[model samples]
Target: MTKVLPSLLASDFTRLGHDIEKMEAAGADIFHLDIMDGQFVPNISYGMPVVEAISRTASIPLDVHLMTLDPEQFIDALAALGIDMVSFHIEATNHPHRLMQRIQQSGMKAGIALNPHTPVAHIQHLLAEIDFILIMTVNPGFGGQKFIDTCVDKVRTLDALRAEKGYGYEIEVDGGINQETAEICREAGADLFVSGSHLFKSEDWQEAVREMKQ
Candidate 1:
């Protein structure tokens, strides 16, 4: 089954606790947190404090996506907060292997994220060392962008590579993932779906999440 992870980036910050309660009740498998630094991505998003706040009330696992330069600088801190999974952009760190090891040693699942413009081959060497792979369907930084069509091919490529190598990493697709686009990704072998605006903006979030999972 494809796991649906609602991006807290697009959630109602005012009613965060209530929103999380509703999403959890709706069967959300994980909570996706987009952590951005203005230097790496054009926009800056919430940081540790916000994540800590979310962790206080979130019952599900926290899947933190770091869209910042030098992601290694924050791995220990995030892990200390009991984050379940930490994914950093492959382009963000100079020491991918070391960073992955640190995350694992810190007791958190490590993942690598690829931007829409990045090729799948870039991280193929480290696939065996990671737990999950996040493919950005839209450029990182902000939410509510249209899905980039070519990203689907990237997902297919990663899925094919995983099959060929027999790697255990899960394929996660983020950005512009709604019911229709999510079906496309799911068909292409993506197992995790990160829905932001489409989910939070829905009149019936429960039905929306259910449709995405279906």
Candidate 2:
């Protein structure tokens, strides 16, 4: 089954621990933490303290998407918190290969995130070295943006490339992923679906999660 990795950035922080517990029970495969810096993106999300708190409570794996410049600085800190996976935007780094090696050296699976305009061919050479690929269906920064349908074909191309090269990197689709959009990406061979607003902002989170996972 296609996995659902819910973005906790949209969750009610006042009761985030409770929400995480609920989602884990609802069959969420992983927790996606969008680590944003005001420089890399327009927004600045919580820092290590908040992440540390979440790590203390979340039973499942934590996949941190670095939306910050110089993401290399956080590898050791994130590794210290036992982050399971870390993805840095290709646009943010000058040396993704080194970053990938460092992330893996720190004991976290390394991934690369591509913005909507970035082509699948951009990361062609790095595919074999990555553990996963995060294709941003919306511009990376804040949550609740509209999904860019154009990115679906990029997912398809990446899927085809993976098959042709026999690569094992999982394809992760983030931004505006709900049941319908998730299904669209899933059809294109996306492995991990990261849903935020559509899941956390739902009136019925269980039903929403069930919808995305299905």
Candidate 3:
């Protein structure tokens, strides 16, 4: 079965504690945090303080997505927190292999995220160097965007690469993932999913997550 990782970017920040509590009760496996800086992406979002705030209330593991330039400069700060996983964009880093090693050394799961236009082949050399792969189905920066149909092929390609090389990296898809697209991604070999607006904006967050896993 695919794992459901609720994107905290979609959670109600005004009542974040309660919003997270509700999601935990609804069987969310992980909390996906999108930390964006204006330089790497078009938007600027929460930093460590916000993640630290949610960290205090979250019951499940936190998968922190760092969409920023010079991610190496911030790994130490993020590692100080107790998040389970930290993923940085491959395009944002100067040395992705070294970054992955540093993340592992810091005792957090290491992950690499790919943009919609970036092919899965970009990480082929580093496949054995990371813990997970985050495939963005929509452009980064903002939420509420439509799913990119091309991502299904990307996920399949990544899956085929992993199978061919026998890597244990978890394939994660973020952005524009809803009930319908979730199944397509899963069939393409996505093991973990990140859903934001689709969960919190929907009438039923629990049902949204449950249906996405199907």
Candidate 4:
């Protein structure tokens, strides 16, 4: 089954706790947090205070995606927030392996993310060292972007590589995921789906999540 991850990026901030509660009731497998810095990404999102608030509200795992240039600077802080997993963009840092080691040393599962333009082969050698991977189906930083249809192939290739190498990393897809795209990625071997604008903007949050899980 494809695990549904509701992105807090698209949540109703005024009622974020309520939204988190609703998602929990809707069977969300994990909570996806998009931590964007103005440098790496075009936009800036909420920081530690907000993440801490979210951490206190949701009982499920919080998966934080660091779309920042200095992702290593945040590892300890986010780990302190009790995030279950932390995925830094592969293009953001000079030493991903060292950073992954630091993240694990801080007690959070380490993951690496590839932008839409990056190929799975870019991180092929390090696949066995990390806990998971986040494949950007659309450009990072913003929500509501159209799903990059070509990025689905990255998921497929990563899946095949994982099988052939017997790697134990989870494949998580972010951006433009809805019920339809969820099915598409699942068929391509995605283990987790991150939903933001589409899921949050729905009239029925629970129903939207339920349909995505299906």
Clash-forming residue pairs, model 1: none
Q: Report every candidate's CA lDDT.
A: 0.92, 0.93, 0.89, 0.91
Please list the residue runs of candidate 4 whose C-alpha ends up more than 4 Å from where it truly belongs after superposition.
Answer: none
lDDT, model 4:
0.91
Per-residue lDDT tens digits of candidate 2, residues 1-214? 6888999999899999999998898788999999999999999989999999999999999999999999999999999999999999887889989999999998999999999988877788899989999999999999999999999999999899889989999999999999899999999999899999898878887788788877
- Say which candidate scores most in TM-score: 1
TM-score of model number 4 = 0.97
Q: With candidate 1 superimposed using the best TM-score fit, by how many Å does residue 47's alpha carbon deviate from the native?
A: 1.3
Q: What TM-score would each prediction reach against the true structure?
A: 0.98, 0.97, 0.97, 0.97
| Model 3 per-residue lDDT tens digits across residues 20-137 | 9999888899999999889999998898889888888887999999999999987888788888999999899788999999999999999999999998788889998689999999
Error of 3 at 75 (Å): 1.2
* lDDT for model 3: 0.89
